[model samples]
Target: MGVCGMLRVVQTGIGGLDVYDVQTCPVPKPAIGEILIRTEFAGINYLDVLMRRGEYTSTPKLPFTPGCGIVGTVVELGSSVNGQSGFAVGDRVVVLTQSGGYSQYVTADARAATHVPEGVPSDKAVCCVSSYVAAHQLLHRAARVHGGWRVLVHSAAGGVGTALTQLARIAGCAVYGTASAGKHDTVRGLGAVPIDYRSSDFVVEMSRNEPDGIDAVFDPIGGEHWLRSRRVVRRGGIVVGYGMRTIRTAARMLVASRGRRFSYYSMNTRNVLQNTEDLRLILNLCSENIIDPVIGPRLPLERVHDAHRLLTDGAITGKALLDCR
Candidate 1:
């Protein structure tokens, strides 16, 4: 148990926000090469909601706590900890908690934790571990985008979309993004040409603008969305995906091939922590004020279910964070 005594957490016996039950329990202990953190804030992600609904790629055992990213202060460390964690007690850090991050405290594998640079708010830092990292990877790693390259980002006002748009802009890329009409201004302000997914067909709009095709397209909305995105990429361009894609879409992905590329980027622990160079660049970007997360709403930990509802239902415009403090 942590020095603080009992821990308060919200969990679900089954997969679904409707099934969440708050409970008080013993704080967990850190294992070898781990640190116990008092979670100050946790990022709410679409994957968390999908995991709860049994729709995500993987599901945790019953009665699991679901939180993907956490920013907090380290209070305790386990045996054999050394230079790798680079941590001291009270050090603020952001860790990618694949699951079990919703609690007041969570133990993280030291390798997965990145210390929050001083002055960056925990709210924005939380976005770094999930959405921001995905955006950076999609542009620099997956698509290998460069200056003047044109890219399309679907859901341009959501967490990953906002991050991807801004980062691509930073890379000197021409970004065409899709969002609801209500968020067109937001998308434009972030340096993307906003296409309304509601009224206009994005594929038709994109083709009209760049008939020859764009350098790359980033999509999270699957199904027919992929079909439309596939039609708009240039002959040698790539279509990058990062959301819960449907297996049934494989045939469509193949049909839309036409010598273009389509690849899904999984937001797993390996993908998150393996690319230290990108992660360092992200931190430097945040630290130097080159990139800023578009944090949408802040809610207390108890209101996590509401946060999930808003995010999954397309009500959230940017990243939503839970104030665990």
Candidate 2:
């Protein structure tokens, strides 16, 4: 390894955490229109777990990097990139890598990066990249949530789940979230009524609490859970499915959503403009102290496996960041 060498986590094969391999490789150069970033933090998303397990339909081929979002400082700009791109070397930014974010250095198109606001930390800005962006899109773009509307969020203690809860509350929506009993306080602290999904049935519970049904349901746990979420929504209300933890669950959710007001959301590079706008708004929110991302653990890059293990075990209460510095 030389001065340009960097460490990255690679998924050599599909399976469990054992598939993650830490390797030292030459830092990748920024291609034309790209910017090389010295990564400060990388977000660990549940989608990474799906890709590592070979469960996601969109999972990349094996031996690829596993992370999708990062916050870092621009170190070098590629040829053809200039001032109009809204980026400069030494500027901190948050960008969606889609893959290859799990490294000490990563490159992204300068056009796709969002400037991190002053007063916001790199760890928190990275959280806004993928999870918070998705959460914002799901609430405002997909669900079109309105103040005073009652909404339900599944897996309320996880990354996107916690984001949804906090943002929904900020939007003036009455929120209800389902998580294990241990996380009830976390959901409750976010101003949402917490329902313990383990011991009690959410359908029965929501129906009992709001007999009129809720306005929207943001569900990531798929399959029969989608059907259950649908049953609790009021007429004309929507069930938005954002993640499929299992392939079978996604398939079952699709079959169950037929003839219903069900919507699905998945962020892609094609939505970079919209995503960047949303990311900027979120970073401002963080800067103003209006809303803060519920940060969980901060693990070093070498502890990538331990980070993933904690996330997969559902032990993390909020977004977890990999300290790439």
Candidate 3:
């Protein structure tokens, strides 16, 4: 603890998550147009890992905290916080903190923070802030998929993949998802035709079946995987790369071996920013039981290392949550 009142936080002075250490820092004060939040849970994502590793396109400076989305209670209101926005003390809200979310408390812009709908748990609501919105934008904004369209989704068992599959199905599209053989059934349950990428070549399987190719391909696996993904799309079809796990892998390997430099920065999430309409739609869907967040595991704050490892290794299905409270 510090001499002054402070909060416990997980911070990284170096580029890797291995450098993460606990420290007591003065609790941040909410500034104008901001709200102080007591973090109940923080949503971890591939972006968090990239940000931590200093490989992401937009990363924080050194000695930083890395977490993308957070669900918490508004503890204090900033002076310029407008009452017309409907935010109040004690309201349960979700904030999309591009950084500084891996902590006991965080401050967020009032306009960007949204109240969680009743009945949605903090763990799941956390996904809606980024993961669900990512899927939403990929399908609707990037691809403009329509009813009866044939869509392909990579990593179909993961958070954004599951969201993409379900959203495509809801849009009346026929989804073809690529995943490991073990996750085939789970992908099928999400209303997608599962392609076993481990045992079979997805490009050949998809291309041979659909001679015209697919309407859209949502690939989080960048690098060579991105090249394959682009091939599965028709001339006019779209290929949207959200997370570049594969590209980041090669970049890490290059750095470790002191080899040629590689960049996976092009596949970051700048294209899938915040959308108020999509947030409202997601929350409404949760309330009506139309769309549900598929959570993989809930790890305590201390298990953050395990959480990141599990996500990086593809050892778990669905979204992972960090229990900060």
Candidate 4:
């Protein structure tokens, strides 16, 4: 909350980053089974770009706030939010809102919130909400990767990419990441073999490295990229797609899936229970140092335009967060 009865938020219409603007309005009140959070950090995801550009199939109506996840302290709880919700005022929590997370304060469903472990940092906990959750599901639920398996993660140096690599290593699988040359060291440091997707043909590179075909390929870069990803996966292995560039890209992926397994993963509230459980598991992993989330550049909420610019220009590695405090 700001002075008066106001709160500041990043608002935008359906357009490019330039359409984004910071404005002040009355602080939002929680509805039944909702919680109001004094936000600490909000994740800046690639999905935001898709939504901003009107490329995503679904999006909020014009003049809306765009943010998918956040880490904050619960400040108020609405009616019927009972003890079982495990939320109390001043308790730190991470939430997956799918929108409205870029404000100084936000309201989220109590059921969609998870308590952050005592020792976990806000930055790391925020990553667990969307990036790590998606990575965990893509591997455990979609790909069903196991120990001794080899997997390739596209955008290996990005937020979800970093999470995928780290979690894969923890599961005793060998990991290969395709990233720009500059991010190779970061990928390699995560115990993954880095392939420069810009300079080298990843399909050929993976073929040379694994020859027998790799176990799984986790790709968010859709379209013919999925076709290329499919070529490297072993006969029994699968290609999991998450991000969509376009409907045609999705169609291309499905057509390319012939004679191979192709699975698509989306992080949504349809399975709130499973997502909350996985988020808690990821927070615990972060607390124990089992998997350290790679945090990249952070900017104050007012500088959100720059944050979006950094993400769009591919100038960020790992997760980029907006400091909402």
lDDT preference between candidates 2 and 4, better one:
2
**Cα misplacement distance, residue 132 of candidate 3 (Å):** 0.5
Q: In candidate 2, which residue ranges exceed 4 Å CA deviation?
A: 247-260
1-325, model 2: which lDDT tens digit per residue? Answer: 1358999999999998889999999998889999999999999999999888877888887789989999999998999888888788899988886799999999898888888888998888888888888999999999999999999999999999999999999999999999999998899999999999889999999999999888899989777778888888887888998888844456444534534478887887567878878888998999999888889999999999899989888899999989999
Q: What C-alpha lDDT does candidate 3 achieve relative to the native structure?
A: 0.77
RMSD of 1: 2.1
lDDT of 3 by residue, 1-325 (tens): 1223434445555465577776767778889989988888888788877776666667777677778788999988999786786999899998766777777888888877888998988887888877888788777776677998998889999888888888899999999998888888889999999999988999999988798877777777776666667667776666666667656443233221222122222323333234666777887787788988888888877778888888878887888888887
Clashes of each: 2, 0, 0, 0
Model with the higher lDDT, candidate 2 or 3: 2
lDDT tens digits, residues 1-325, model 4? 3433434555466677778888877778899999999899999999988988888777778778889899999988999987777888989999987789888888899989999999898988998899999999999988898899999999999999999999999999999999999998899999999999889899899889989898889988887778888889888678888897544356444534556788887877558899989998999999999999999999999898899999988999999999988
> Which one wins on lDDT?
2
TM-score of each: 0.93, 0.95, 0.87, 0.95
Worst ten-residue run, lDDT, model 3? Answer: 256-265
Which residue pairs in candidate 4 have backbone atoms (N, alpha carbon, C) closer than 3 angstroms, thus clashing? none
lDDT of each: 0.81, 0.88, 0.77, 0.87
Question: What lDDT does candidate 3 reach at residue 125?
Answer: 86
